[model samples]
Target: MRQGLGTQLRHLIDLLDGAVSAAYEEAGIDYRPRYTPVMRALEGGEPRTVSQIAEAAGITQPAATQTVTLMMKQGLLEASPGVRDARQKIVRLSAQGEALLPQLRLCWQATRAAADSLDRDMPYPLSDALAEAIAALQTQSFGARIRAARATTKSKKETS
Candidate 1:
């Protein structure tokens, strides 16, 4: 039997992230794949609010908040009051996170080369496919597609 699309996508993510996680472990870096986006967002050395981080990282605010909270707990990020908004928390890399830059840069370079090699082996690049898929979903969401299919099914049933 063929695997479902969701299952296959999950398996792909697991395989990719598992290898990435192992790479960090082997390099003696205690970081998670999820943290990379937020780190990238804050790597510019400018403090930004959670909404700004979310926008910069191409992630949802809630996801950014969760990641920022976790990173803060791990001492990789520091949060302070936004300049004009006392309730808004501006986030930036902590000293520890700054210290990891050189190591992470090396790891990122290696990961990029490995990804290039992987793309060369395949007919279609995974990164391109991901971008295309994201674009398609932005055009017509999965829920919309499912609802259209459901309507067609109902029409077929009514015709019968």
Candidate 2:
């Protein structure tokens, strides 16, 4: 029997994750798949709040917060009080984090090259297709439920 589309996609994701993780390890960098999206989101000119980072990263606020905390401790990020809202904090990458950006890019490039080499004869469109699929899935009911659950968990953690 043929495997389901979701199963194939999941397998692909797993393979990609492993390749990326191995690349990061080989490059002597701590691998955090979750942090890459958040860092990429913050690559824009503006500094972002934890909530904004979470939204951009497609992760729950609590997860973002925890990741931010870890990055901060690692000197990869710095948090400053917001100008208009004293209670709010804005997060940005520190010098160390900025320095690591190129390494991250290299790791991605290596992973992409590996994927491309898997089927050299065929034109590989998986990256673009996967990105589009993710964007579409983000607007679906399952995505909404996942995000809501993450948010709820974050809120509960904060309250406790």
Candidate of highest lDDT? 1
What are the per-residue Cα lDDT tens digits for candidate 1 across 16-41? 89999999999999999899899999
Q: Give the alpha-carbon lDDT of every model.
A: 0.93, 0.82
Clashing pairs in 1: none
What lDDT tens digits, residue by residue, belong to model 2 across residues 22-41? 77888899857667877887
TM-score of each prediction: 0.96, 0.65
- lDDT for model 1, on a 0 to 1 scale? 0.93
In candidate 2, how many Å is residue 28 off? 1.7
User: Candidate 1, which segments miss by more than 4 Å at Cα?
Assistant: none
The clash count of every prediction, one per candidate, is 0, 0
